[model samples]
Target: MQPVINYLNTNSGEIINSLGQHLTISFIAAIIAILIAVPLAIILINHRKIGELVLQITSVIQTIPSLAILGLLIPLVGIGTIPAIIALVLYALMPVFANTYAGLTNIDPLLMEAADAFGVSWRFKLFKIQIPLALPMILTGIRQAVVMIIGTATLAALIGGGGLGTYILLGIQTNNNNALIVGAVLAAALALIASGLIRLLAKVPLKYLTFAIIGIFTLAGIGWGVKSLEFQQQETITIAGKMGGEPEILINMYKDIIENDQPQIKVKLKPNFGGTSFLFKGLQSQKIDVYPEFTGTVLQSLVKTDKAIPHRPRLAYQQAQKLLQSQYKMTYLAPMQYQNGYAVVVRRSTAAKYHLHTIADLTQFPALKAAFDPDFYQQSDGYPGLKKFYHLHFQNVKTMEPALRYEALAKGKVAVTDGYTTDPQIKKYKLVVLNDSRSFFPPYQGAPLVRTEFARSHPQIIKSLNKLQGQITTKQMQTMNYQVTVQHKKASQVAHQFLQQHGFLVQKSSKR
Candidate 1:
């Protein structure tokens, strides 16, 4: 409880910023949805035949996953707020459109006959009579749309659309329970608030309803126009990264470097964009200019070559780099000093008790129980390769979150766990990384991957980034991760401190 409170207190400003962003995106999406849906509903009410086909199409759009919609739009809209809002509008359409058509078409026939007898204009009847009676139903639809949009807006964060989802994704990556709960609670609160506000609006006199709706659109238009102008004026260089502490650090490092050295370029940090697949897609599609990636991830998981490569780091890196350059027109910068490869770790106490110092030594303890992350547990290059190479099999194996594996080991629930070589938990829990004497695991040296076209356009930026090569040691990365996960520092702050201590920022400042 105290942790939650402290986290909120410290991040209150960011929380407010995220809340504002969330509200803006939802409001814009809902307003746009209303504009399209209400008119379409009126058309459908008049022509029942075509309306059925239109509704079917909208229903199909609604069924598409929100995340998938964002992905499909990335090539067309190029990510960020535009694609996010477009996806939300599509999701918000079905409820409001259906309700509007139903409300207008289901009006009492006797009332329409009376209006017809009086020779009232159809337009006047729609504005004065039919719409007035259908206000509640339409408002109800609006309320539903607003609520759903607010909830769905969180997915916007996956595409670098800032909102509460930013905190939620960060929390998941860093294993911060407090941050995760805060984001979830705030998003729900926003949805409830939106629903409540729209319900209250339902009570407004029909005379002013049009005026109110018009005012809402007018204001949203002005805000969106201003935001669009801002986006257009800036030259943005988007830096994407996969989930986890290391990626966050590297992205922040790239962001800080570009922003500080070249103030003219807008550095957009798109954190928590899933794993290698998403990053690769972004690079290939020209949605992201740069991203931090691991060498082994490209070689084994992405490239999918079954032929055995040397267990050597340089050989593996060269092969992966060549493949990416040839196939995707992407370039890998010089590798960092650290290797963040998979390692089999055990508590120092257990290591001492069992005299386990290497992968071969583990074969003697066939009774040992182990835990692995789901991806590592199933990868052909993971347990299968390790087992075949080392001729060892654990008595029992469990799949669990990478963060929880340390706790499981601490509680003696598992004798061994799969861990990253540079994980901060390794140091915090006093875990011993067993040597892969037979070299079953491939090297995973850290590096930044950039699209060749982007690199060609920004030679200075590329040069500035190259200065980071071979700067961060494995211990240095572990300490930075510890600062973020254990001490709860922002990844950006840790990255800035690393840059300052290593004279990266100093060089930038000296130029000024």
Candidate 2:
């Protein structure tokens, strides 16, 4: 509890910023959904067939997984707030539309008849009688949509839409319960507050209620437009990174170096941005200016190769650099010395019990359950290649999130899992990394990946980034990850210390 308090105290500014972004995204999505759904639903109340068809379509959209929706939207609309809001609006539509249609249709038939018999205009029948009576149900739907949108907005962080989801993802990846608690608690609180506001809005007079809604929407639009314009006027370079403490630290290092070397250029750090594929897509679409990439991942996942990649780090780096330039027109800069390659890890006790010393030893324990992250489960150089080369298969294999895999292994939920060489959990969990006797996995040296056009336009940025070449070692990376993950140190602080120690930045003088 105290640690959580400390985290909150230290990160209040960021928490507030994230909260603002979360509210902006959620509010925009909910308003758009209400605007589209309620009027359409009311009109369709008189046309049952079209109403049913539209409701069915919305229901189907709600059934698709949020992550899948985001993935699909990436290629079409690109990443950031736009796609996130679009996906949220789609998810929010069904509840509001269905509720509005049902409310209007289910209004007292006698009351609607009374309005008709009195010779009231059609507009009076709708605005005065049917709509006034149906207000409760409509408000109920709005409440539901607002709450749902707030919850789902967390996923926006995965695609560079800034929100509280940043803290949530970081916590999960680094095993920081304090960060996790903060994000979850704040998100729930936001939902409750929004729900309460909707309830209050339900009690207002109809005319003023309409005026209030319009005023709120107009104010929000103006504020957001001003903010967006201000942001666009600034020169910013967005640097993103994959999930994990190492990538977070590396990106912070990159940010510090580039800022120190070129003070005029503002660098925006989007740490734990997403997986390899998401980041790659962002780069291709020019949504991100730069990000860290592994040489082997480029060869195995991004570039097409009929032949096997060599195990040597230099050869793998050369091949990746050449192929990326020729194929994608992306520049792969000089790599760090550390090779954060794949490792087959097991608990110390499990290794002893099964006499597991190498990848081949796993064949003897086919019954042992294994847990793997989604990427490794699907990537060619990951599980598939390992299984084919070792002739080993676990009968009960679970596809787990990257952070959860280590916890599962530690708790004896599974006996084996794939890990990176520089993962802090390797030391924390006292796990054994089985040797790759057959050399099935390729070397994965980390480097800065940038678009060729960006590289050409900003050669100074490239010069500052190249200072990281051959700088970090595997042991040093492991230590830095441990500091961030275990000691609860900030990645930026750790990165700053490393840079100062390595003469990249001048050390600060001690104050009396």
Candidate 3:
């Protein structure tokens, strides 16, 4: 509880900012959904066949997973609030549309007939007769849709859409329960508050309710538009990182270096943005200016190669650099002095109990329950190749998120898991990394990858980034990861300390 309090105290600004983003995205999506759905529902009220068909389509959209929808939108619209809002609007459509159609159709047929017999205009029939009675049901649908949008907006953080989901992802990646609690509690609170607002609005007259909803959303949209315009006016460079404490720390370092070097150029950091593929696609689409990538990941995952990449760090880095330039038109900057390569890890107690000393030793325990990171389980350079080379198979294999794997292993829920060499949990949990005697996993040296055109145009930024080359050693990286993940330090603070300690930044004077 104390740690959570401290976390909140330190991150209140970020929390408020994220809350704003969450609200804006939710409000905009809800408003758009309402505008589209209510009109269509009203129009289709007279056309039962088209109404039924539209409802069926929206219902189908509701069945699709939010993540899948985001994935599909990435190629078309790319990442950020646009795709996130689109996905949320799609999800919000069904509830509002269904309920609106149901409400209008299920209204007292006798009242509708009486209005018609009175020779009231169609407008009066809709606004005065049908809408007044159907307001509760329509508002109920809006409430449901608003609440759903608020909850689902968390996933927006994955694609650089700012929201409380950023904290949730960071929490999971760094094992910071405090962040998780804050994000979850705030999201739930937002949903509840939205539901309550709608309930209160239910009591208002239909005319006032309509005006209120429009005015509120209009102000929100204006505020969001202004914020977006402000960002667009700035000379901003968006730098992103993969999910984990190390990537987060590195990106902060990148931000600090670039901002300090060129104060005129603003640096936006998107830490724990997503997996390798997502970041790569973001780079390709110019959604992100730069991100940290590994030589081994490039060789195995990005570049098309029939032959295996050599396990040597220097050679692998060279090949990755050249291939990315020639094939992908991206520049792989000089890497820091660390190899955050893959490792098979187990609890020290488990290793001692089983006398496991190497990868080959794992072959003895076919029944051992192994938990692997999702990417590690599927990537060619990870479990697939290791399994074929070592002939080791675990019957109880589960693919887990990167952070959860360590927790599972530490708690004795699993006997083995995959990890990076510099993972802080290795030290915290007293885990033993089984030696890759056969050297199955390739060396993964961390480097800043940038688009070639961006690199050419922003040589100064590249130079600022190059200051990291050979600066961070394996031990330094492990220690930094430990600081962020175990010691619960902010990545920005840690990066600042590292830069100051290493004389990369000027120390500030203390005024008496």
- Give the number of the best model, judged by lDDT: 2
Better candidate number, 1 or 3, judged by lDDT: 3
Ranking by TM-score: 1, 3, 2
lDDT of 3 by residue, 172-270 (tens): 777789999999999999999999988999999877877986898688779779978988886999999887778888998898888787777778887
**Local distance difference test, each candidate:** 0.84, 0.89, 0.89
Q: Which pairs, if any, clash in model 1?
A: none
Clashes (backbone N, CA, C under 3 Å), per candidate, total 0, 0, 0
Ranking by lDDT: 2, 3, 1
lDDT of 3 at 100: 94
- TM-score, every prediction: 0.91, 0.87, 0.90
lDDT of 1: 0.84
For candidate 2, the clash count comes to 0
Expressed as tens digits, the lDDT of each residue in 1-512 for candidate 1 is 89999888876866888889898899889989999998889877879988888888889998899888988997786656788999999998889988888899899999999999999998999988888887788888889999999888888888767788887887876678887898899999999988888888888887676699789779878988998899789798888887667788899899888877887788877666656766777777777889988888888766757567657988888888888888778888888888999999998888999999998999999899999988889987788778888888998999998768888997899999898988988888888999988888888888888988888888998988988887788889999988877777778779988998888875553322
Error of 3 at 264 (Å): 1.2
